[model samples]
Target chain A: MRKILLASLLIPALALGGAGCSGKKDAGESGTQLGGTVHIDGSSTVFPITEAVGEEFQMLHRGVRVTVGISGTGGGFKKFCSGETDINDASRPIKEKEALLAAEHGIGFIEIPVAFDGISVVVNPANDWVDHLTVAELHQIWMPDSPVKTWRDVRPAWPDREIKLYGPDVDSGTFDYFTETINGESQVSRPDYTASADDNVLVTGVAGDRDALGYFGYAYYAENTDRLKVVPIDGGGGPVTASHTTINNGTYAPLSRPLFLYVSTKGGERPEVREFVKFYLQNAATLAAEVGYVGLPARAYELGWQRFESGKTGSIFNTDKARSGLSIVELLSL
Target chain B: MTAGEWRGVPNLARRHWQSLWLRRLFQALTWLGVMLLAILLFRIARQGAVWLDWDFLTSFPSRFPARAGIKSALAGTLWLIGLTALISVPVGVAAAVYLEEFSRAGRLKTFIEVNIANLAGVPSIVYGILGLAIFVRGIGLGRSVLAGALTMSLLILPVIIIAAREAIKAVPQSLRQGAMALGATRWLTVRHHVLPGALPGIMTGVILALSRAIGETAPLIMIGALSYVAFVPEGPMDGFTALPIQIFNWTARPQQEFHGLAAGGIIVLLAVLLLMNAAAVAVRHRFQRRR
Candidate 1:
């Protein structure tokens, strides 16, 4: 009976296997309408905002194919510089190396600051001793070869227990921004820790262990406030917790940074891409707030629209290296 | 009288029709299953076929769906399976051998047997949590290749032992008796005859178990495997990513192109599974011929 069953199962599978041997072309062209594929890929931090825009934009322009991908900021820039994507979502401004690569590929892009994001340091809800962390303390905990091992090591009054660290993986813009701003260098944090590109994993990791400490986008912390405690940061002006008021007013200090969408000059020339960018800017402030990011101020939005309208090319951060810990005002002046 | 009673005519047409219906039902069910598999294979192939090239296999994962490759993930999977096999095979086989040959049945034995059976039925993700606590935290192995392999080894150990035990049970009792009767010690007789006879079955089980381990993404995820690993693991202690995790990451991305890449990753995984099963069948066939 088992042999019969086996043979009966195998025969049809073999037949289907033979049928599957052939292939088909993915012809995406649709007959006569405003239609073209607009590919967007970038930081998962920026993913929620782009996805909201992409969905609403698609609803209005049914003929256009808008796709969004979360490849982390660095990975997105890699694709953007290679001319593979129409728009690149970034949690931070484009780095000097990324701009150089884009120039090398002759891929001129316009950078539009879309929103403000705060990277929130968090610990388990059970962690009561850590009300806030100083920048020097963050450096002590995360800087390469630092001596901070236990909770007691961070402060003299805390309990003695191993500090289980979790953070974004190297691919993440969050990791880059955090290390750059706090440790005063990019990708220079200590190698020992639990890391994931997905923020939820880190959230779960930190939430599960009492001694666990981690950081991710402020939106994630806000969403998981019940399970995790967001740590206030003292940037030499007393501890300031991440909030809409603090993040929007730029009082969130070094952790508060602008999010962006880089549009290719060639792509913007296309009617679909041009219309989409216009729609994106008009709705960014509204959608940004809806997605838990601070909408850029009215003036910043105007400047962004102006920049896009003028076909502004090259990055405002035109240097050949990452400029860390810069405020939105400083970036705007530059 | 008895002969006459037994000679009553069989219900020929009824029996024939009943058998025919049963056979048709089986065929229909089989085809239904086959249709589902065919649809899945067809969709994956159509989506990913264009992207399945040498570069896709060899290149490191990039943010650009087109530039992203599975080099790190592919290498990590091979390393995971290799290390898992090394750890589980010896331990699983030994446990099976001791349970089958070394001891008499008792409450202790019964308890172990029932627990092993239950362990086989536990969800894979639960094992991931266990590994995170025991290996990643308790043992401080971190989320390295060694840690993942150890976790996977535990996940598949019960299945391997159960398979090994069944294989060992099938070895003829007389063969062991014959070897012992010829002045061989009990250990020698079991080792030389029983173990040799069960080798093919045990090997088949181990390979199939390893294949299942390779396809697993949950426990690895729970233990904090990186979603994007740029470099291949150089040592067992180094960080790594597997094919399933990479596929999951790509599919989770909002981009249509990465969805295609995820499909491509699935195709590669299916191919690896098929290869392992083929090897198991070949080994079984070779052993059957020798017997």
Candidate 2:
């Protein structure tokens, strides 16, 4: 009551009246007893899993609330290392320098593999006869320096079509991976492709236009299978379509990567954060697959639970609070 | 009246010489300001020069940030600015001309004037969402460069219209009075006497609007400009990228090399902006001095 009165009194003084409060009311209403807010942001690719897991986690653990924001992978990491979020949903692993930034900020986090995703190559269903494409053809289509202007330019025997393209924006991890795998560099792509941070937009673009091709997360393609066709990416020899089986068996090429959620060890000691992470690992598998992401083996969640349990005992955690001025170059070189 | 009185001002010259102290003080302050401005521009130019070069402008981003060129971004910015100018200049000038020369002082005109004034302060990012809704999604333009240009035109329109009005207002009333007296219609008087006088000021406003549009990151991002474009765009509708997007992309990367690249991207952008400003100032001054 006093807090509410104080807030009312202080309202006019707030040039920053629109607060960017990260606390979730349903999760953490108290400044004590696991009742503080847990803010999670990053990776539209990992957003579905994070959102699904966060919703269920909050439902199960009534006292702990979680909110997830999808700002792409690199964008999420920037906020994560800035200490804006307690957990970050990342499509790719923390790069050498990102790890150092977290260390510099005294933020030690536990990296847990939540699920797996296979980046899917989608084409308009109107075109037939084309089933597989080599990495060289992908280079022809996506490489920054490629001179190929049309589908026939890619392969002269194919019908001459003005190849329309769509893909993720540069800040996306999937874009980085596609560029690395296809163009032999990260963040390098043919500028001609229609780009968006949202995968749904890419799906719509590919589905609406004939002679168009796009790449996005497999789940989007799966959901829109009736409207769009999945082109098999040639993995050296045979064509490979991203499936639960193929992706799990490691046949989806370099684009198949593990999705992650990093829980802050320091923050996890708090009841709400601890309860939320515990609830997350406890039900993540079934709920993850329900949200169209591949679930990991049962043993993984069990180990994570054990770690979370050990964390309360002050044994399983190495708090970054003690490491002031930790060498960034040293940590990154590791 | 005949203007021959200034030639007989021998005694008036001595009186004017008494104004020398004020002129000397003004010159001193002016020199001080000029020095300060030069220093500021020098600092900005030097910092930006670290990243501007032929190779730097032409290369695509690599793992090593130093190797990345802003060719696609430069190309995209040019297309966006050129298209934005094409849409805005004629439209904004026409609106200004109508408002100044045609629209009588009335309720509707006052409403429009107030609204245009209010629009000048409307946050740029609002235009982004508007573009997203109207151009990208609603009209199904779908993140095309045309959509971005249309959004930018809306952003800079207020400033152009306002500047154009001021430019037309600054024209001597005698010029219009003379043109009308010579048997010209109102339209003819404005076209023959006013527009020629206002062109330099309109160009100045245009160059300034283009400057604001080129540096704006929010609306463009909202309308879906690419950050890592690989190829140069050839048409208005082609998927495009720009300099600010490239700078943002590089700044967000974890690599140290990218930080340098971000700084470099900033330099290239500033140089283009400076060039545009310098050209506009020269044109405006040239025209003013000629008249």
Candidate 3:
């Protein structure tokens, strides 16, 4: 009976306490008190930058809730195209099919390039023979039914050890980018190689095996430089290793891809969403760099802000091949 | 001579040797399981000890690993589990009592029983999809804590109901008869006699179901739980992130420091689970002593 009496008293006291706190918050903020939710879902690759931006945005606008989900690039687009999410973070440009779906749903989106991510090719530290690999060599190794089995098969001066390959799984955007660039088609690869969605597993595999060759995101390679040797890629001009400068400057040819944000026109019209997008573009350079991704040039962000403010909706790159030789700034300007 | 010697051996001696070998094999298998768990715990502790601190428990997740913490995720998990328990327990226990004590045994009962058993076997991701469609979209909860809790309730309802039915069934039939003989109504008998007897078992089942819900990442992910929530949820309508999702996000990062942070998150999760189970055990013991 005493417990019941105490509980009855405590409930009202808790209610009063909660009411008091909320009243204080309402009274404390007087001007420009923006309150709403900004929902974002998309690529795990761009998740870090978006998450960082969301965190800082929330700190500034306490009433606006920013929620970010990692549903992979395609899955995020599924939600984005359906108008379920305000913004979608994409590691690659929206596919033709996804664009058609969005158009069908009457969901117009503004494409804003946020960061640069380079697909890095890495090998075991023990392998001393490989100095660089040409685009053709990569295609020869990863292409379906390729005859290259041993390192000696590629070059007679190299050892006769059987080459063991590792790479990202088929579902990943990284796999899509790598296969399209290297094999000239998406999802085309040799079936016998070890594949995992987790880059750390690939890192561990190459670190343990002397004959292993693997490729994953540049961040993974940057994290495990001691255990893995990064192999420079020769697109056409010359071999260039992946670095922040190389990726940002487009020297990392045929590999450095721009990450993007697709914001719905309907969502963009909302004051909270508009403010959040502006903040994201303004701070994405520093946040992207902090998260180990290459930030886009200042002029690129300027172009993005202009495009977003003007409400220009739809993708700029008309074809997948259009992205190969052109930089993000050039594409944005177009 | 060899055939005669084999026939002459005592049958008991051969049976004894076989039994001894079987016992030894079972003992070895048990040891292997325990050793594996011990090794895993040891490795996690070794990696996470340096990272676990007061700040880790107080601060929100950050891009910088040193400043990142599980405060928001921890609060979200507590809210989810608490709300899930509140929603699932009474409904589950009542359903169990109805099926075990009140409902007539017929084709309907048999079908319901079979479906519940099958639902228990269904992969959790299937429930996640259902939750995504029904609660998140159809009900328009918009990825709030209430939506997540409701989805979790659905996911764990089958396990709770089955466990609760067993607990209710374990109550002695004579107790009901004795209460009825004393002029008690059916509802009164159940409330006074059967439910008290089943309380400890029900509590145990509820705690176990809740523990499973706490660690689940797939269903929550399907329901659109955010992986990056910096602030603690202030109400049921607020967006939230849980401990498992935070750990998953951390482990997926390319940085080595984040991996250590994941280990720390696991330690925190396990501690929470242990505390819950201990409370369940204590409650069960008190109820049993009363009986």
Best by TM-score: 3
Write candidate 1's Cα lDDT for A289-310 as tens digits.
8767888777777778778888
List runs of model 3 lying over 4 Å from the truth. Answer: A1-29, A318-321, B1-9
TM-scores of all predicted structures = 0.52, 0.48, 0.94
Q: Candidate 2 residues B221-281, lDDT tens each? A: 7665654444555455556778887777655442335556777777778878998788778
Worst 10 residues of 2 chain A by lDDT: A313-322
Please identify which of the two predictions, 2 or 3, would achieve the higher lDDT against the true structure: 3
What TM-score does each prediction get for chain A alone?
0.84, 0.77, 0.91
Report the CAPRI category for model 1: incorrect
RMSD of each: 18.8, 22.7, 3.3
Q: Candidate 2: where is the Cα deviation over 4 Å?
A: A1-34, A299-334, B1-291
* Model 1: how far residue A265 lies from native, Å: 0.4
Q: What TM-score results for chain B in every one of the models?
A: 0.93, 0.83, 0.96
DockQ of each: 0.03, 0.02, 0.49
State the weakest 10-residue window (summed lDDT) of model 3 chain B.
B1-10
Worst 10 residues of 3 chain A by lDDT: A1-10
- lDDT, candidate 2, A19-99, per-residue tens: 223334423555553454566766756765665566555445544445454456675676677566777778776666777
lDDT of 1 at A316: 70
CA lDDT of every candidate: 0.82, 0.72, 0.90
